[model samples]
Target: MSELAVPGIAYGGDYNPEQWPEEVWAEDVRLMREAGVTMVSVNIFAWALLEPREGEYDFSRLDRILALLHENGIAADLATPTAAPPAWFFRAHPDALPVDRDGRGLSYGSRQTFCPSSPAYREAALRITGELAARYADHPAVVMWHIHNEYGCHNAECYCEASAEAFRGWLREKYADDLEALNRAWGTTFWSQWYYDWDEIIPPRATGAVPNPAHQLDWRRFCSDELLSLYKAEREVLRAAAPSVPATTNFMVMYNFDALDYWRWAPELDIVSNDHYLQSTDPESEIDIALSGDLVRSLAGGRPWLLMEHSTGAVNWQPVNRAKTAGELRRNALAHVARGADGIAYFQWRAAKAGAEQWHSAMLPHAGTDSQIWRDVVQLGADLRALAEVRGSTGTAKVAIVWDWNAWWSVELPSQPSGEVRFQDLVRAWYEPLWRAGVAVDFVRPDADLSAYRVVLAPSLYLVDDEGAANLAGFAERGGTLAVGFHSGAVDENCHVRLGGYPGAFREALGVRSDELFPLLPGEPVGLSEGGTASVWSERVRLDGAEAVTSFASGPLTGVPAVTRHTHGTGTTWYVATLPAPSTLADLLDRIRTEAGVTPVRVTPEGVEAVLRRGEDADYLFLINHGDRSAEVEVPAGAADLLAGKPVEGGTVTVRAGDVVVVREPR
Candidate 1:
C-alpha cells in the first residue's frame, strides 16, 4: 500500500465546521492559510449531523466544507464520523449500546457508546463509511482516509449479551470447538471452572474472586481483536471506494486504559499516526512525548509518522489544566519532529463555542489570533516549512527497549508480587535514564529483529512466550548487550508459571535464578554496593555463572546480587533484581554503553535532549532545551544551524530554555 501521499509535513488539525455557522468556515480557511496549515481533519464527530435521522443522509454542508478547504490549498484528512453513531440508531437498536462491567447499560450521551460486537452497530458504521468513501473518493481535497477516531478508547470491552455471544464464537474458532484445550490453557481444573461447552464461558466480569488470569488475558486479547474487526470493516469499504487513498486511525499509545494492541493494528494501517496528550501532572511529560513519538515511528517500522493530535495550550481534561509556558509548545512539537514525526497537528483548529471540550486549547484559541498560543502555532507552522527537507527522514538508534502489550497485560494482572509494580512505571524507570543520557532509543516488540541494536532493555516483562525467549537468547548469543529488569520472564503466554524458578525463560541467558520476590514498602529502600539505592522491588538472586556487579548491602535479601552480569558467546546479559535509582541506572547504562561500544550522539546538561535524524543527503541534530534556564551545548564543527541560519564552528552554542536548534550536517 502507498504511504500518506502528502508533500512536506502535513500540518493543521481536526476542523469541525459543522459545529460552527457556515459564515465561520471561510474565516477558518483564511486563518488556516495564515498559519501555513497544509491539511485539516474534518467530519470526525459529525455522524449525528451527517445523518440526523435513520436512512437519511445530507452532504450539502460537508461538500461546502471540503470545497472551501481545497480552494484555500489545504488537503483534507477526511474522517468517516463513525466513532459516535447517531443517537437514532442507538434508540432503534438498544442492543448496540455497551454494558459496563457491573452489568449496567451505558447511556448514549458520550461518544464510542456502541458495542463492538453488535451487528447493528457494525452494519450502520459500514454503511456510513461506504457512503463517505464513495462520495469523497474522487474529491481533490481528500488525501487520506481517517477512520473512526481512537478505536477502543471508551468501549474497550462490553459484557452485553451480544458481546457474550461473539466471545463464545471467538472462543470456538480459537480452540477449534475443543473445550479440553480451552480448559487446559485456562488451568480451570484448579478452580473447578472447567467448561463443558462454549456457551458455558462468559465475558470475564466482576466475579466473586479475582478472575482467572488466563481468562482475563484471553478476554483482553478478544476485546482487542473485536475492535480490530470493526476497524477492518470500515477500512475495507474505504479501500474499495478509494484504493489510492491511504487509510489510518489515530492511536493513543500507552494511555493506560486503551487495550487495542497497536502492534497488531500497525500492520493494517498505510501510515502510522498517534494522538499524544501530555501528562500535566507529571514533570516528565516531555520525556513521555518523545517516548510516544519514537514508539509510533518504530510501529511504522522506521517510516515517517504523523503526530495526529496534541494540544496548543491547556487541555480541559487534566485536573489542573496547566497552560504551556512561553516556548514549551514549540519545543514539544519539535521533539516529535526530531524523533521522526513528519507531520505535526493538534486536536482542534479552533476552540469550540459549546461542547464537552470547549475549554480545550486550539490553533485559534478563545482569545483569537492575537493570543500567544496562536502566535506559537503560527511560528511552529513556519518552522515546519523551513525544515521541510527533514520530511521522510528517520532517526537512528543503537538502543532498543522492548514493549509488549501482552506482557503489559500479564504484569498488571491482579495478585502480582506488588501492586506498585505497574508496567508503565517499570518501563519509565528504565527509559528515564536512557532518555536523560540523550540516547535515542527505539521501542521494539520482543520478537523484533535485534541485530541492528547493540543494547536491548526488557523491563518487567512478566510473560515471555517461547519464541520471544528464543529471540532474546539469540540476540545475546550474537554479541548484543541485554538488560532484564525485575520480575521479567516469570510466566508463559498462558499466564502459567514457568515452573523452574523466577524469571523462568531468562534464567539461563541471565545466568541467575531468583528464589524469592521482596516488594519494598513505600519510602523503604535498599542500598546497592555500587552506591545508589534500589527500591519498589527486590529479589533474592543466586548467581549461577554471572558476576554480581551490584550487591544488596542491607535488607532481607542482603548479600544477594542486586545486579548481575553474565557473558554468553560474545555478548553480555545484565539482570537487574530491583528498580535502581535513576543515578544508579545511569551509571549502569554508562558501563553497558562502554561494553557495547555505543557512543552518545552528544552529551549535554540535564533538561537538554540531543537527537540526530539522518536523511538521504543530510544529517540533522536537534538540541532541545527543556529546562527553565538557558544552557550551552557542544556542536559538531562545520554544521549549520537550520533554524538560526548560521554556521557553528564545533564550539559551544547557547540554547534558551524551552527552545530548539537543528544543526544540519553533510552525510
Candidate 2:
C-alpha cells in the first residue's frame, strides 16, 4: 500500500546477510539493484546472531545490513526474528520445548521448536520484538513490519503439560466455566466420559481407540487461537512503538499448510500476505497457484496481497526437485499478479552454500549470473518495472466457494466413512472446472454473507454449524444458485450427525435425501444415467420435491437419483450424490452458471486463464496461456499491452505458450 512506501510492486526476497561474509554483502546489494529490486525481507531467523546470549544485545551486523540496503535504495521488510530463538534460550528454558502427540519432547536443532503456549517463549519473543521496534522503528530503509516468519509451519500445537493446562483454561473461557456445558459441546457421553472437573480434560492425545471428534475439533481451534494471541501480542508491542508501520506475517495458505484458520487471522494484520510454493510433482500445479492467490486475495477482502515467498526454480523439500522450464518462472510469478498480488518476492535472494536449504533455488543461484535462473531474474525485474502502474488493482468475482478450516479438520479425522475423502481434493474438483472455464471465484466461510454472490458451491462440507446452514439456505432463497457437494450437510458443528438422513441439514432446500453412502474403492467406477462414470463415492438417493437429473445405472442403487435439481424460492439448488467425471462435472457447472446468469465480460477458451483487476481508472486484463497451443484473446477496445508497451493489433493477440499478456483498458 501507499502507507508502506512501496511505489509500485515490491520485488526481491529474503536477505540473510548474516549467513555470508562482509565481502558478500556489497555484492548482494549490487545484484539486488541490478535486478530492479526495491524491497527485501531482512533479519528473519537471525535471533541467534542478534542476541547471542540472554540479556546481551548485538545489533552491529543488522545495523550494517540495513545501512547497506538503504545506501543501495532498497527498502526493508524488517522481520522481528521471533520465529527462531537462540540456542542459549532453548537450553536455559528447556521447558519451552514442544511435545508431540505421543509425548516425545522435541529438541532444539531446527527453527520453530518452541511451543506457543510456553510463557517463557512468549516473554522472550516479545522482549526481542520490543527491543527491535524501539531501536529501528524510524530507520530509513524500513518499509513494512514482517512480524514473524510462517507461524505454524513447524510447531502449530504442543501436547505438553503446560499446553494441556492452557487448553483447559481456554475451554473454561469458551464454555464460561461450566463443565456441564463443555460435556454437551464435546459429546463425551458416548464413551462414558464426563468431565466433572476442568483438570480432567486435555488435548486429544494418543489413545488406543478413536479420539472424540469434537475434542479434536476444539483442540485445533484452541491451537490456532493460541498462535494468534502470540502474533497479536507482538503486534501490539510493535504498534505501541511504531504505529505507522504496517505489520504482517507470511501465511503458508497452500498445500503444505492447513494449520491456521486464516479467516480469523486475516483481519488481525495490517496487510495480508502469503507464501505459495508449487508442488513440484503436480503437473497441474499452475491451477494450485491460482487457487492460492484467489484465497489470499479473498483473505485480504479482495485487496491486492503480497506474494511473500516462492521458488525461482526447484525447491529443496520435494521428493525430486525439478527445474523450471524456459518460460515457467515468469508464468508462475505473473500468474500471481494476474489474480491480485501487488508485490512479488521469493524465499531467498542467494542460494546458500551451506545449511539445510542450500539446494533451494534463488534469484542468484549457486551457478552465478551466467545461469538461466539469473537471466530469467533479470528479465522479470525489467518486466516488473514496466508493469509498475498495475499496483492497487483489485480482483472481484460473483462466484464463491466455501473453505472452512474447522470442517477440513473434522472431515479428515479418524474413523470417518472413507479415508480417501480429502477436503482439499474435493475443493479442487469443484474449483478446477470454474478455473478452466476462466471464471474468477473467491473463497468464503460457510457463514459469511453471500449477498454479493450469484453462485456458491460448498464441496464436501461434512461439518457445518446452524448459522452456516442458514446462511447457505438464505443465499438460495434470495435467488442465488447453489451446488451442494457430495457428503456435505451430514454433520453439525459439534461433529454430531444430523439424524434425519444423509445430506441432513440441506435436505429441505435440496429436496432430496440419500439413504446411504457407497464409498467406492480405487478403480471402481459406477455408471451414471447421464452417460458418464461416478467414482470414489455414490449414494442411494430418493427425491422428495426435486427432479432426478440423472440416475445410477449399475450399482445396487440402480434407478435411484444420482443428481437432482430443486427450485427453492426464486433460486435453484443442485445436489451431487457422487463425484462425477471431469467432463461431466464441467458441463454441469456450465449449465448451473448459465442458469444463474453469471457471465464474464468475455469468454476465455479452453487453455487460457482470464482475470480482471480493476483500478481507479482502468481495468487490467491478464490472459495467461497454460496450454501447448497458442491462445487467441480478443483484445478489449482501447486497450494496450502493458508487457510489450504497445497497442493490440487487429483488436486481438495470440498468447504464446507459457506467456502472460497484460492488457490495460480504461474503465
TM-score for each of the candidates: 0.98, 0.98
**Best-fitting candidate, measured by lDDT?**
2
Task: Give lDDT per model, in order.
Answer: 0.89, 0.90
* Number of residue pairs clashing in candidate 2, backbone atoms closer than 3 angstroms, sequence gap of 3 or more or interchain: 0
lDDT of 2: 0.90
**Which residue pairs collide in model 2, if any?**
none
Return the clash pairs for model 1, or none: none
What ranges in model 1 sit over 4 Å off?
Answer: 649-652
lDDT of 1 by residue, 430-464 (tens): 88878888888999999998889999999878898
lDDT of 1: 0.89
Per-prediction CA RMSD (Å)? 1.2, 1.2
Model 2 weakest 10-residue run by lDDT? 1-10
